[model samples]
Target: MAASFQVISKLLGRLSPSISHPLRQYLSCLQRLPVGSRPGLSPFVPPSRSLCKAALPRDEDAAQATEARLCYKDSPWDYLESEDYIEKYGTNPVWESYRRNHKGGIPPQKTRKTCIRGDKICGNPCPVCRDPNIIIHHQNVKLLQQFISPHTGMVLDPTRTGVCMKQQKKLHEAINTAKNHGFLPFQIPFVEFSGADYSNSHDAVGSTPPPQSLTSGETWYKWYSEITPDENEVAKVKKTYKAYLK
Candidate 1:
């Protein structure tokens, strides 16, 4: 940074006479200054690349790998494997370990949207939000399964699981991705169609004419024939409502 200033000073020194009085004064100040010093400037030090990298959020692939590696020891199941799961929780699942003690009459339905606000984390945050190290990945089946129903094969509601909406959404997306990658079964709703719906045999849709119109010398539709009401039935109906009809 000092070297850049020195080059600028040299250029300005040559054109000092023609330049404005303010710039000339500034050039004189630069010359009078020490080799590495500038007027009204603090010392410059470049940040280490390692430190910069540490400052940034990890990429999805890196986060997944880190989560997987940690899961080998951190989570009991090694992500939904039976042997590790049996060793860890025995027959029960992680959701069974519910923290019951609370100050309020009714416990909260769900966790907050986020734990940290501009680098400050609130006290006693939710399980999902408490740890910065916990990452949601498609391959993390064991953790993902906790947010899903074992018997019903549906995602557990955020209210029931006490998961924040943000984390719940992430869990949802990861579960779908894992299913797409063939880790879990894609549980889709069952649909049944009536047999008649598939056939085009109805009057509005069918291409064929009436059944016996061609053979029996009758109009294709009976309504197309010259129509007359029974005189007695028409007169009785008219007489029954004569006041309104008139």
Candidate 2:
């Protein structure tokens, strides 16, 4: 009976070691992994759909809030009319006021009255008025040439020319019209000179004879020859003027 008990005890010891070995290995693997690494485990809990929807912004509400404080501004050309210009600057020649104001800062705007009033009566004389009969027209090539620089094809500035804004505008328009019509001379012409004769003697210098006179071809007008005056005719004119001189 004692021998049978010993054999049973040995068999039980062998089974216990095999079961414990696998359990120890599994526990060691679990310890090495991060807290939330296990599959099928809920690491985080999401908020409700109602809370998420409340946090979003409405696009229409933001757009409406920004629309009330805006305003439109007019361009510089918009002040070309007499009324708008008068409000900003008084009736005065643009060129005169431009020079005065420009001394310190930028010039003021030119009103219609300033350009309309003749320079003789008006306090200021604009660039256009200083020269008479300087009409700004497409046909007026001479007038247009004055506004443009001969050296450079650039248009002269209002300050340099002393012209009012109105005249400047008209001048620019005339120049453009002339250019379009092919009236203005765009290209400058070239000229060539022959070398001078350097002969020493007066006879040698004057050796070239007078050009040969040709016959009056296709005679339209009468040609008169040199008239020789008599000595007696000259004595009568001198005697008549002698009494006036005394």
Candidate 3:
């Protein structure tokens, strides 16, 4: 192979210097190439990218946060007392800082039906829904207290509080439960008791006179005998309640 390459190079050199020089360089490059590589194919080079993606940042704080959230979920009342709560919300109610996002100058008439639906959650969740720590429970009286009006002793409206209907419903049930259990005060409207209602002096409550003996064919009361319903009115009533009348 060496002798054949030498002879071909010499013949090409003798024939044309310009063409021979280029052919010689080409032949030299082919010879220098590794044994198994075919003429047309380029050498393979692995990608610069790694086989696996770079790991994301993991912090102890993240784990602690999740653990803290779980603890709050178990006992939501504790979260109200926690330092995190103080730092985040201070002394104000959970709904105090919340402002609903709206299109124009006037706000919406009602809060959203729900903040979360299945796994998907909306952009602006209600006060109860946005915070994972705020779980509705009858026992969480402190959390429930924020939702109640101090003056009226009534649960705050969903529109005013920016609470979703679903959470508001839950708030109502929990508040009622708390009130029933005596954890919270039950509001009773003030009414002046009338002595007349308790007394039996009223005509309706007074003892009736002895019944008048009547024949079997006669009605006990004269009014019953005098009750003459108009035929047209009776017929109209029967027609109006045709399905119900037997």
Candidate 4:
């Protein structure tokens, strides 16, 4: 009977609340923790809300945008067809407007290499060439003036004016022809002195000596005086000759 009672006591101790209470408490604590949280793992941390927002563009980006806007504002060829250009300038040498706009700089477009139909070997043809009827000549004074500087009287370079070699040659010829025809003014005349004159008259201007004497030293001349020599003057000559008289 005592053995059975002790066995019953052991079984009851095994089924006691000591283990159950600890396990229940552990489960309750686990449920209370956040879903993202783990005991030994790092806690859940999201990026800051400020960092998640998009950043504004920097100064460089804004500058690029401005430049793009400026680039698109006007086409490079606008001056070609502007009516204001025609009125402000004139039709005498209409191309002057275009040259003025692009002076000291290259045009945006390249000149054509040959005639469109290949009938002729044109070195460089401008925009007007493709459309025909635009002629260049010495008579076009205004156009030629644009190529020449008003201050220095020198022709502008091809790189600055975007003129090809062939056109530049023609332009020079035209300028010369214009000058010959009085359409362009020739360069102002300059004074230059030739070498100095060294003639005898030039040397005598400030001479110190009087005119040369009628007779030089040791020269003989017949006397024109009427009176003969005096006795004393004749005797003096005889006395001086007495030593040779013997």
Top lDDT prediction, candidate number: 3
Residue-level lDDT tens digits of model 1 in 1-246: 557667766767677576745665766677787866755433334655867787566676678756665766455334446454456556554545545335788877656776567878757554566544345788777677777887898998765665667777888899999999998776678899998878888777889764662656677777877787799999999999999984
Flag regions of model 1 displaced more than 4 Å. 1-95, 98-103, 208-246
Candidate number with the higher lDDT (2 or 3): 3
| Tens digits of per-residue lDDT for model 4, 55-140 | 44456677765664465344423332345445655554333333423335555454333334457634444423422323357776
TM-score of every model? 0.45, 0.29, 0.64, 0.33
State each model's CA lDDT, in order.
0.67, 0.56, 0.86, 0.57
Clashing pairs in 2: 127-162
Ranking by TM-score: 3, 1, 4, 2
> Residue 148: error of model 4 in Å?
0.6
lDDT of 4: 0.57
What lDDT tens digits, residue by residue, belong to model 3 across residues 1-246?
Answer: 557668877788787777788878877987798767636422324554444333222456678889998888778889889998899999999999999999999998998999899999999999988988889999999999999889989898898999999999999999999989999987689899899979987889988878788888899777898889999999999999999977
Q: What is the C-alpha RMSD of each candidate to the true structure, in Å?
A: 18.4, 28.8, 12.6, 27.3
* Model 4 residue 41 distance off true place after TM-score fit, in angstroms: 69
In model 3, what lDDT does residue 161 have? Answer: 94
Each candidate structure's count of clashing pairs: 0, 1, 0, 0
What TM-score does prediction 1 earn? Answer: 0.45
Worst 10 residues of 1 by lDDT: 39-48
